[model samples]
Structure formats: structure tokens, C-alpha cells
Target: MTTSWWTFGLQTVNFLILVWLLSHFFWRPVAAVIERRRQMARDLLDQAQADRDAAAQALEEARRRSAGFEEEREKILAEAWREASEARSAALVQAEAEIATLREQSRTAIAQEEEEAARVWTARAGELALTVAARLAARLDGAAVTETFLRWLTDKIAALPADVRSTLGAAGEVEIVSAAPLEPGLQRRVGAEIGAALGASLSFSYRIEPDLIAGLELRTPHLSVRNSWRADLTQILAEINHDERI
Candidate 1:
């Protein structure tokens, strides 16, 4: 309150010096430290940003890889399903083909068996019929029957192959009925009868039978005929059957 002007000026100058010294020494260093700290903090923030960006990028890559794997899995599954379906179809087709082949084979085999059986039956029936006819014919006998039978038998025998006809035994030798002898009439001229019937040289043998109801049965290698009552009845019945057929 009692200060001079010079004292006031001096005090102002001193205050200015103090402010300058404080700024140069203590405050300036502190500001620099603060600025340095702020720069370091900024650098740390940049590094953290970069790390976060890298992490995000890695996550994206991992997502992409997962997507690729998933796509592959889906593709593989689809392919597998397709293959399985194809395989199933192929198996079904194969099975059907095999079944068809087997069925055809079975049909063929059955047809073959049937044909063979028919052939065997036909052969057996033919043989049995011939044998039965031979046995039946042996019992027949008669003069008129013998003449008719000789005519028919001669014609049939002439139709046979020469080799078979040549082997024929004498007509009289073949016994129709064992109990009776060959008729003396046929026995006397058997050679001439055979020669006339065969149109060639001939031989003969004698046989007799009574079972034919009075008739004669003649047989050659290639021909047989019963000239007897039994044959007469059979012929009549056959004629009746033929009339019925007509």
C-alpha cells in the first residue's frame, strides 16, 4: 500500500522472469513428458487396432475354410447318395435278368423233359403193341381165314425191305396154335405158296394150333396175320368202330 512506481515495475519484471524460468525448467519438461506419454499411448492404440484387424482376418479365413469343408462334405454326401442309388438300381436290374434267365432255362428244361418222356412212351408203346400182336396172332387158325391172311400178309411182306423179307422163316414153321399141326393142304405146297407170295425161291416149316376157333396164323419176318374166329370178330368190331367214326 506504500510501494513506489519503481518498486512496482521491478516487481512486474521479477514476476515475468519467474514465469519464464518456470516454463523453461519445470513446466517445459513436464509438457514434453506428457506429449511423449501421449505419443506412446497412441502407438499402443495403433498396435492394438492392427492386432484386432489380424484377428478378424484370421477368423474370416477360418470361416472360409469351414465353409469349404462343409461344401466338400455336402458334395461327397450327394455323390455317395447318387452312387448308392445307382448301385441299387444296378442290383435290381441284375437280379431281374438273372431271374429271367433262370425262368427261361427252367422252361426249356421242362419242355425237353416232356419231349423225352413222350419219345420214350411212344417207343415203349410201339414195342409192346408189336409183341402182343405176335403172341395173339400165333393162336389163330382156319382155311378161308388162312387164305385171306396169306393174301394180306403176302402183300405186307412184299412191301418190306428185301433184306428183312429174305430173313423171314417158313410160314408153316411159325406155329399159330401149338396143339395142331400145319394143315396138310398148306404143308404139301408151302414151298410153292411162299414162292408165289414172295415172287422168289422160298422154304417152309410146319406149325399147328387149335386155340384160334379153327383158323391159321401166318407170319414172316416182316408180316403177320391171324386167320381165325378171334380175328374175324376183331375185324367186325373194327368195322363197326369205323362205321361209327364215319
Candidate 2:
């Protein structure tokens, strides 16, 4: 193999020149493009992160507003319920008062009606008793009733005090009234018996009064005595009616 030192030198020089040209031209432009692409990607990533933070803040604000609105609604509903309850209680109280008033009025009216009824019944009973007594008295025998009253009168005069009897004895005259005319024999007997009982001579005069309803009456100027069915019945009816009222 023959040695070629010059050709080897020339090949080495050409390789060195090619390497410097590629480093100055192709390598520098490619490095610059790659650096520009990397810078753009970093800017996009930072912008995306900022947008995400803004969206998160907005969502939080909306949630807080919604919570506040819910609280306000609940407060309003509670106030409305309280007002309704108070109104219902007031209405109930008013209704109860009205009912009590009505009951009192009814009781008063009933009491008044009962009192009126009792009064009417009492009056009717008095009238009926008076009617019955008048009918019974109408059927009595006038002469017999008069005789009985005369006997009673004689006994009453006999039982008088000594002073009263003496005063009667001193009177000028006595009067006897009857429902019917008495027989002359009966009149003489009555005058004689009464004068004997009083131990004094007395003058007597008899008068007839048909309204006496079967009874007798004795009278002097200072004193009078009546024993008649009509008078007795009137007093009895008055006493009965007074008791009923009580």
C-alpha cells in the first residue's frame, strides 16, 4: 500500500469546514425556533390557571348568596305562622264571650217567665177559692145561722170583764141587726136573756140587712160586734191569699 499524506490532509480540511458551516447556519435557526415554541406553551398554561381561579371564586360567591336568600325566606315564613296563631286565639276568645252572653240572657228570660206563671196561678187560685166559699154560703139556712151567731154573741158578752159589762149595762140602748126578720117570740127571748146576763135592764131594737148572708150583728153607740158568714169568709180568704204570696 503506497502512503498519501497530502490527500489525507485535504480531506481533513474539508470535513472541518463542513462542520463549521452547519453550526453557524442550520443549528442556530433550529435552536431559536424550539425556544420560541417553548415560550408560547408556557404563556398559555399560565393564562389557563388564572381563568380556573376566577371561575372558582365566582362559584363560591354564588353559593354564599344562595345560602343568605334561604335564611331570609325561612325568617319570613316563621313570622307569618306566628301572626296566624295569634289571630286564631283571638277569634276563639271572642266566640266564647258571645256564647256566655247568650246563655245569661236565656237564663234571665226563663226566670222571668217562671215568676209570671207563678203569679198568674196564685191569682187564679184565690178567685176559685172565693167562688167556692160564696156558693157554700149561699146554700146555708139564714134563720139557723143567725140563731147560732146570737148564741155565740151571748156567750162573748157574758165572758167580758166586769168593767166592760158594767159599761154595757150603763149604755142607753143596744141594736141587733139580722139577715132576716126574727119572730117576735125570739126577739123577746133574746132581749130578756141578754138583760138578765148583764144584770141590767136594757132596751133592744132589731134591724134586718139582707146582705149579711146569714148572720147577726150587735151594736151600741160606743161598741159594735159582727158575726156574719160574709165577713168571716172574707177574712179567711184574705189570710189564705196572704200566706200563698209569702
Candidate 3:
């Protein structure tokens, strides 16, 4: 078919108009919408990345803060424990100091009491010595004082001291014991009794007091009894004188 020139021209014009219409109206608006959507997606992705970074930073900061809090709590607990221990130690020291003070006070009191007692005892002893010396001066001297006093002393000693008189018998024996002219039986009797009482054996001496008018005299360290006629006669004469006076 032979195409007409005018139809071809019209068809070309229509094709051109369609392309222009698509480019200007449909393609331009569609491309603009697609670009806008792409931009929005990119911005959302950037925001998500920023949020993730912020979360990671916050988490690290929270962990550091938690660790610092734990360390502080432990330090506080340790300080409290140390303070309690110091308080206990101070209390114990005070208690020991009080005990030491009490002990010293008690020791001082006891020492003072003992010293005072010793002083009192010393004064009493001095007074007793003076009294004993005065009595001794009266009885232990003077002449015939020896012979006559010895005679009197011997008889009185046979009766024992007033303190021990009750233990002695009414018929106490008298022996004039002698190492010389000494009889064995005399030694045995005197030694046994005196040994039992005093836990020691007795000693003897020989004596012939030419002054003794008759019977012998018995003697021990602390005792001497005169069993003599002279002693008896003197006593009898005194008794007769007493009867005459009555």
C-alpha cells in the first residue's frame, strides 16, 4: 500500500505528543514520588543507627555507675566494721585500767594496816620489858639472903609454880641427885618423867650445903626443893609463934 504523506505526518505528531505527555505529567510526578520515598528511608536508617549508639552508651554508663555504687557500699561496710572493732578495744582497755586501780588500792590498804599493827606490837613489848626488870630488882639480891633465901626457895619450888600446881601430886618426891656419889636409880626416875614432860633428860649436881641441918635437897634446872630439918624447924617455930599470937 502506498502511504499518504499527510497520515504519516499525523501519526508522528501523535507519538511525539504521547512521549511529551508521559515525560511532563506521568513520569515527572512518579519519579518525584519515588525520590522522596528513597530519601525518607535513608533518614529512618540514620535515625535507627543513632538510637542504637545512644543505647549502647547509656548501657555502659549504667554499668559503670552500678560498679561504683557496689564499691562504695563495700567501703562503707568495712568502715563500720573497723569502727566497731575500735570501740570494743577501747572498752577492754578501760576495764583493765579500772581493775589495776582497784588492785593498787587494795594493796595500799593492806600495807597500811600491817605497818600500824607492827608499831602497836613494838610498843607493847617495850612496856613488858620494863615491868619485868622492876620485879627482878626486888627479889634477886641481898646476904644470908643466899642461904636463907635458898632454904625458903627450895621448899616453895617443891610445891611447883602456881600455874602448874594442879598437875603436880600432893606427895611429890624430893631427891638430892649427884653426878658424884650418883645412884643409877635416881637418874632413871628423874630422867624418865622430865624427858616425858620436856622432851629432854635432866642434869644433876652434887652439893653438901653444910648449912642444911638435916635431910638432903632435890634440885633440877628450874626447881630445887629443900627437905631439911632446918627448914622444918623454921616452919614449926613460925607455926608456934602463929598459935601463940592467935
Candidate 4:
């Protein structure tokens, strides 16, 4: 083959020019674009990593808040249960106190009723005793009983205090009350006996009082001497009533 040095030099020169042009324009611009794209991709990757860390922190905070809420709910439930128990205990104590009060009142009422019944029976008994005494005294009224009562009246007048006896004697007239009318003979005898006992002569007036039952009573304007079964029965009834009260 015949060698061509000029052609070879010319071809070599063209290839060097082409290489410089590509390095200055196409290669430089393409390499710069690729480098910029790579930098953008790295920036995106860094941003994604930061976002993941922030999201994880937020999730942890949410979990902590949830746990706090659960603890608060338990506390509220326990406090409510404690209050309810206290209320129940207080109600039970009140109910028992009321029941005890009612029972005491009932007992007091029953005791009062029993006492009232006993008092009523005692009063009735006292009345019956007085009635029986009065009837028996009435049956015993007679001439012998009259004579006996006249002796008793004379003795009663004799036994009086000196001042009382003097006052009775000083009175111009003395009244004699009896259960029945006296015979004229008996009246004279009775008046003589009374005058002898007083040591002074006095006027005598007679009166009938059936309520005396079986004895005599002497009466003046300001004085009364009761020596009779009726008076005795009245004293007994009063004593019975007083005893019942005690």
C-alpha cells in the first residue's frame, strides 16, 4: 500500500479538533446536568429521613398521652366507688337509729297504757268499798246504836281541848244532828246529859241528816264536829286514792 502522510496528518488533525469541541460544549454540559440531578436526588433522600424521624417522635407522644388518659379513667372510677360506699354506710346507720327510736316509743306507750288501766281499776275498787260501807252502816241504825252514839258524842265533847270546850260552852246555842228524829223523852235525857258534861246550861236544837248513816254530828255556825260512819268512810276513800297515786 502506498503511504499518504498528508492525508494521515489531516485526519489526525480533524480527530483532535472534534475531541476539543465535544469536551468544550456537549461533554461539559451533559456532565454538569448529570451532577445536578444526582445532588437533587440526595437532597430528597435527606428530607425523607428527617420526616420519618419527626413522625416517629409524634407517634411516641400520642402513645404517652393515651397511657395518661387510661390512668385518669381508672382514678375517676375508684373515687366514684369510694363515695358510693360511704353513702351506703351512712344510710344504714340512720335507718338503725330510727328503728331504735321507734321501738323505745312503742315501749313507753305500752307502759303508759298499763299504768292507766291499773289506776282505773283501783278507783273503781275504792268506790265500791265506800258503797258497801255506807250500806252496812245503814243496816245497823237502831235505838241501841243511837244510845251508843250519844255516849260517844258526850265523850268526844269531854275530851276536847280546854279552850275549845270553853268556846263551845260560851256559844248560846248548840245544834245536834242525827240520822233520824229523836223521841221527846230521849231528847230531854240527851240535853240533860250534854249540859252536865259542858258544866254550863245551853240551848239544844235538833236536826235530821240521813247522810250521817249511823251516828251524831254537832254543828254550830262556825264549827262542825263529825263523829259518824259516813265521815270515816270518806277518810278511808281519800287514803285509798292517795295510796294509788303513790
**Winner by lDDT:** 4
Q: Global lDDT for candidate 1?
A: 0.66
Best by TM-score: 4
Query: What is the C-alpha lDDT profile of model 1 across 68-157, one tens digit per residue?
Result: 999999999999999999999999999999999999999989977876676565546544544455566554544555666556555765
**lDDT to native, each model:** 0.66, 0.77, 0.56, 0.81
Candidate 2 lDDT score at position 207: 93
3-80: candidate 3 lDDT, tens digit per residue: 778788889999999999999999999999999999889888888888888998998999999999999999999998
Tell me which of candidates 1 and 2 scores higher on lDDT. Answer: 2
**Native RMSD of candidate 2 (Å):** 13.4
For model 4, residues 32-122, the per-residue Cα lDDT tens digits are 9999998888888888888888888888888888888898889888888888888888888887888888888888887777767776766
User: lDDT by residue for model 2 over 143-212, one digit each (tens)?
Assistant: 6766688887778788888888788888969888877788999889778877876789999999997666
lDDT at position 214, candidate 1: 44
Candidate 2: where are CA atoms >4 Å away? 1-138, 244-246
Ranked candidates, highest lDDT first = 4, 2, 1, 3
lDDT of 4: 0.81
Question: How do the predictions measure up, each by TM-score?
Answer: 0.45, 0.44, 0.36, 0.50
Preferred candidate (TM-score higher): 1 or 4: 4
Model 1 TM-score (2 dp): 0.45
Rank candidates, TM-score, best first. 4, 1, 2, 3
Stretches > 4 Å off in candidate 1:
1-55, 127-150, 157-191, 201-246
